[model samples]
Target: MNGVSLQGLRVFLAVVESGSVSGAGRALGISQPAVSGHLHSLEKRFGVALLDRDRPIAPTRAGEKLAGHARRVLAATRELEEEMVRQRAPGGTLAVGASTTPAETIVPGAVARLAAECPEVSPRVRVGDTEDTLAALLRREVEVALVGQEPEDARLEARFVEEDRLTAVVRTGDGKLPEVTVEELSRASFVLRERGSATRRAVERTLRAAGVEPKIAAEIGSNAAVAGAVAAGAGVGVLPERALPRSPGVEPLRVKGLGFTRPLVLVTERGRRLSPAASAFIEVCLNRDGR
Candidate 1:
């Protein structure tokens, strides 16, 4: 009824189920007099005789209907309590995906900065090629992605982190001079990154445009692996400059007519709001407001 408390409803239900005030009080951790008082208050508020006080307590028709509502109310209360606890929990784990180049370059730096900023949060970073990262994003396995190319899906929103340009890295003493034309480079043996990689896709387009078929020697997983293979004189590999280790064995070569650049994007699902920590990490990557 309008003025009856939840405790009053519990007492009424317990008394009906137990068939006696003393038994209901023991079940509810209250005295027999307290249980009787709550039952009386509930009946007075509803202006109805809810039970018969005889040898064994029994509920009237109105009490049965109120009991059904009380169960639903109790269930809803439990759900609300669980939801509130989940919201208040701190430092939830965040899952993220990245393409190889950006994963090697920016992700580690961003994660380090994020760790300093949000010490309580724990991060789980997954590395993949372009298509795999996008697949992870679409599947909701990762809350955010650092991708080599911008995502075109309407379900994703992206911010440009940096412009990524493809370069050919070769061994230093191999006598392969810098500034080779696209056609000549395409004719040479090439150690390409794996298929579905953004760097590989861009390099393939440039080779096709120059009307030359590239002889791909190998398809490697990480940028470091590709660079290592190239350093061992396997072949010139198409990769990002940031992926190359600062050593004498490796040197980046420029290719004429192969000036292709794709944007590195920080992407998240559309219409899904980010947590404060996730949003802050994205903002740091974007460097929005230059803070």
Candidate 2:
């Protein structure tokens, strides 16, 4: 009917399901008088006696027909709302934060896959160190993050995406760099990533475990910067293996006793529901085939 409200239909369904006016009030969190008022209003609007108020309430033939229609209407309304949410997810902008290594090596492929799957979703990416990326997540500046290390915050969830190792890089003319030992690394001046970088942390931890403190010559911000510094003979730089560009002036050398590896993690705020675009991008990052 023109005057019929969804609220009246909801109360009708509650009464039908609960089998009593008092039970409907309890289920709908309203008073018994309010429930009765709603039912009276609904019956007046439809010009039909909907319920037979006996010892236990029962719907009349007209009430049964209206109840069936109410169920279908509610279901269709729910489906419409869900479809709207799905449409907004793929058409809206998705913000993502990424640590330096993954920002350079991993995020591009995932973004490409997302573009192929959902062209309408415009992904905005912010690149920073591990700590900065986590901060961005906490501030809700980004919906998801690809970080080099697992976040320790209780409010964050991390999933392992892949593993990456740090390689010792030196200048191409640096005496035909071969496999070197940890002892040799200790003596060399290292152009390492800045303090908050996951790659720098892994490199320093490995060096400390070997009882050799690396001589820090230059502390750079990004992996690309570290590679550039090494090529210019600033010092030996430690960077993710995949981050080492195939430039003529730089060469990657393996350390014999040192293995610097870190987990590449996909991080999201715990208990936060991700949009469909963000979820799809995560699937691309985790699955090798981008499925």
Write down the TM-score of every candidate: 0.66, 0.71
Candidate 2 least-lDDT 10 residues: 240-249
RMSD per candidate (Å) reads 9.9, 9.1
Q: Candidate 1: deviation at residue 163, Å?
A: 0.7
Give me the candidate number with maximum TM-score: 2
Q: For candidate 1, lDDT tens digit of each residue in 1-291?
A: 468687887888898899999999999999999998998888889889988888599888998888889888877988999888766543568788998888888888788877877776678999999889988988999889998877778898888898987677787776466588766776678888888898888888777777878898888887788878888989887777766654346688877756767789998999987876677678668873354
Candidate 2 positional error at 111, Å: 0.5
Residue-level lDDT tens digits of model 2 in 185-271: 779999999898888888888889999888899999987778888889999887777766644577888788778889999999999
- Which runs in model 2 stand beyond 4 Å of their true positions? 1-89, 175-177
Tell me how candidate 1 scores on lDDT.
Answer: 0.81
